[model samples]
Target: MNLTSAAMIGRINPEALGASTLGLALYNTCLMFGIGLTAAISPLVARERGSGAVATTDAIRRLVHAGFWNNIIVVIPVWCLLWEAAPVLRLLGQESRLADEAASYLHVMQWSLLPALIYLVLRSLLAALERPRWAVVTGVGAVVLNFVLNWLLIDGHAGLPALGLLGSGLATFLSNLFMAGALSVAVAVDPRFRKLRLFQGLGRVPWRACATLWRLGAPIGIGIVLEVGMFTAATALVGHYDPVSLPAHAIALQVASFTFMVPLGIAQAATVRVAGAAKRAASARAGWVALMLGLGVALASAVVLVTVPEPIIGLFIDPSEPGAQAVTRAAALLLGIAGIFQLADAAQVVLGGMLRGLQDTRMPMLIAMFSYWGVGLPLAFVLVINNATTGVWIGLTAGLFTVALLLLGRWWVFSSGGRRPPIA
Candidate 1:
């Protein structure tokens, strides 16, 4: 969806793309809150199912119910923030026009947050149950739906208004709504998932279950916010630096984010696989295998980013356009830097997932805080003062590497020789 938006908006102008990118960054930062909180569903469900506990099915259903409530709780404040995004961006030192444009994007795009987070909760449940086929199908369909909507709405095809960035935002909103509804139907109809009765009692709060989710999920949510907030902060900082840098950074980051989804999926799978393991050695083996798979995919992604950045950048912006040369050049450089950190980024996320399966989140949250803020943000500030956009990415790379190393060490300590953390 971002790629589609960026490509179409870039055709309008670099400034438009920059504004939209900043809006997206802001929206995603807010989204991390819901994502982090609901992430507990998978690990909790997986562990319960693996434990052979009585009424495990009921427990898992209650977790999913709590997850939906949690989503509603998180989205309320996020919507408020996004509603005032223009002022917030201006306060962050963004240009007034850019901030307003970004805010307009957010006003419409923010509506997608609830549905998107709900989809995540459902997807996580499906993944935990190992009934992920429908979720996958729904996601692919949503992407295609988003693309067609983008083409029609962004440029006003089929007599539609040329909504530009607003159109992109609307497309996202509708696609997410579709995703959430489609997945719900899938869960309802599929014989395997229907028995779970995931949506049976929407009104029940399940206070104990909700409290348990918060206790375990808060650190995970906070850790994600810290990490995503760092990147969002970077985007804002780059936007403050120069016009071209914002769009450039957005394009590069989009490409990197697209690739990161590979390892992200592996990491989620790792969480489920490790959580389901019956023994310590089995868990250790699952973690290591997931890590290896993630590293291999990251390496392949890095090579592509390094080898053919221009072509990739071209996909988002017109290289032949006179105004785009600077943006293209800057994005290409940033893409290379992004490539350098692929392994670190992949390792950190995959390891983080493994640790989540172990229900070891609080320390990882501190590690993320220290790595991204204590280290990455400060270094980026120093470097950006000297090296412009390049400095910011270099600092980001350093932070990812630091977090990855720390997380790996943490994983080793758990896998080595110690009493395993109790499953919640």
Candidate 2:
């Protein structure tokens, strides 16, 4: 799902104009909810240490084992989603050929779900255990694999069939597999990780851990829904005006995805650092780590995007056609707004991470709902339907700000209150 939108935004023809884009948007909506499931895993694993019910290491080990299997459990829904992709594409008004193409793309991509989920478990366990550098290596490797295969498969290079959209899907599946296999191998070989036998068996911890995971994750997942949904909805709303506007919005979205990695990475790191600090009763350090990296990187990323919006956008847009001109204008509008959003995006994610560190997800979800649905969506509608692309930017920027403010308040309240102090 992560790669799905990127592929669509990067490669699909906007001029072709079909329901595929809208279908993809709906798929993304569901995928966003699935990601929320991880929020449940991290805090549950982290809290085991603070509660004195389980030693930190043991709790983390159990989480790794349980999480690996929990991923397997989610595969059922992944399969169903893939099976439904074609029908959904048809209903969205996609052309026959495009729907066929998308169905194949979705089918191959679904196989990645289990592996991606496995990698997610590894990431959460590693982060909650304060070993996030594990993520840096594995994640980079997976991304590289995705890109290389995208070129090969999409272009039909290296004796591989040129599957186009389906090829991109294949690339994504392979990338997830690479990450899961590499991480598993690394863990198996490392004496520290080996002792935990993270992959050995869940034995009896599955139900308890799954319950705990849902409890922590449901809210975080809802929060992601609101966040990702806001961007997706903006594009959809803009699409009402004309074909080019929405695709241009998608281009800007792709660009933002690349830049957003920083805060998202920092946020994950913050979640781990803060969770660890909270488990150790180190409130000051937790708050500092969560905000400091988030602040520095957010500013840096936003500035880069703002300063060279054209060049950054050029990478994703073909510069030689009339289509290019339309996209360039729309991309510029979206990027300009995105530059402003970087601040709030950074603040909100880091703020949420800080809350994750403190084992609070419920409030953040509420904040996201109010900010995106209550505020951003309505504002976007008024402006977008009125053909105010610039106003769409204003609405999204405001949403990000609202999220940041509310999330920051929650972080301070939870961390300062010390609701999750370590076992004394």
Best lDDT among the predictions, by candidate number: 1
Report how far residue 409 has shifted in candidate 2, in Å.
2.1
Q: Residues 1-424, candidate 1, lDDT per residue (tens digit)?
A: 6676677778777788889888988889888878888888888888877787754567878898999998898889889989999989999999999999999999999999999988999999988888789989999999989988988888899999999889989998999999999999999888887888888887989888888889889998889999999899888889888666888888888888899999999999999999888888999999999999999999999999998998898888876666688888888889888889999999999999999998888889999999999999999999988787899999899899999999998889778977665443
Q: List the residue pairs that clash in candidate 2.
A: 36-221, 40-216, 40-217
TM-score of each: 0.98, 0.87
Candidate 2 stretches with Cα past 4 Å from truth are 1-24, 47-58, 86-104, 202-205, 278-281, 414-424
List clashing residue pairs in candidate 1.
none
Name the runs in model 1 displaced over 4 angstroms.
Answer: 419-424
Cα RMSD (Å) between model 2 and the true structure?
Answer: 3.6
Whole-model alpha-carbon lDDT for candidate 1: 0.88
User: How many clashing residue pairs appear in each of the predictions shown?
Assistant: 0, 3
lDDT of 2: 0.69
